[model samples]
Target: MGRTDELFFEMIETYQRHAQTARNAKYQETHEMAEILLNMDITAMWCLTQRTPDTRSRLI
Candidate 1:
């Protein structure tokens, strides 16, 4: 598989783990860590697709 594909798959797993962490965490710091992972997920997905919010609507 391509490096991008690998990265994306890893990102997906990380996102899933973080989502679970967020669900279980009760402290503010833990919540912040989970939010950071969520942001990473978004950024990784954007990178895989080469996208930005200001760009024209993507076909995918």
Candidate 2:
């Protein structure tokens, strides 16, 4: 194979690997959230929020 073809294949492989990593992370997050809800006995609602770098306020 030519150098250009090799580079193209390498780029595709890298992209697929990165995509799989993202997919796995998302799956893990979902599984953890489900486990938390299942193990909780309270009727309280669960919310996920991210803290901003500049403020104490949380973004849901």
Candidate 3:
């Protein structure tokens, strides 16, 4: 994997961790917002990977 790929995965992990933290803290609104953001990030990542066959292969 390249540096960019590593950074992308790190970002996703961070968002997921933050969402769980918010949920654990009983911040329902924050948790929901975090979840939404996480989904958006994943969607964006998927779309970006789809733009290149090499990236799509690496992802799989």
In order, the Cα lDDT scores of the candidates are 0.75, 0.42, 0.73
In order of lDDT, best first, we have 1, 3, 2
- In TM-score terms, candidate 1 sits at 0.68
Count residue pairs with overlapping backbones in model 3. Answer: 0
Model 2 bad stretches (over 4 Å): 26-60
> TM-scores of the models, in the given order?
0.68, 0.41, 0.63
lDDT of 2: 0.42
Candidate 3: tens digits of C-alpha lDDT, residues 1-60: 776677668777877786676577566787777778778777877776877677788768
Predicted structure 1: lDDT: 0.75
lDDT of 2 by residue, 1-60 (tens): 545444445555655555555456557776565445443412221211122232213212
Ranking of all candidate structures by their TM-score, best first: 1, 3, 2
lDDT of 2 at 31: 55
Per-residue lDDT value at 8 in model 3: 69
lDDT of 1 at 37: 85
By summed lDDT, which 10 consecutive residues of candidate 1 come out lowest? Answer: 51-60
Number of the top lDDT candidate: 1
Clash totals in order: 0, 0, 0
> Better model by TM-score, 1 or 3?
1
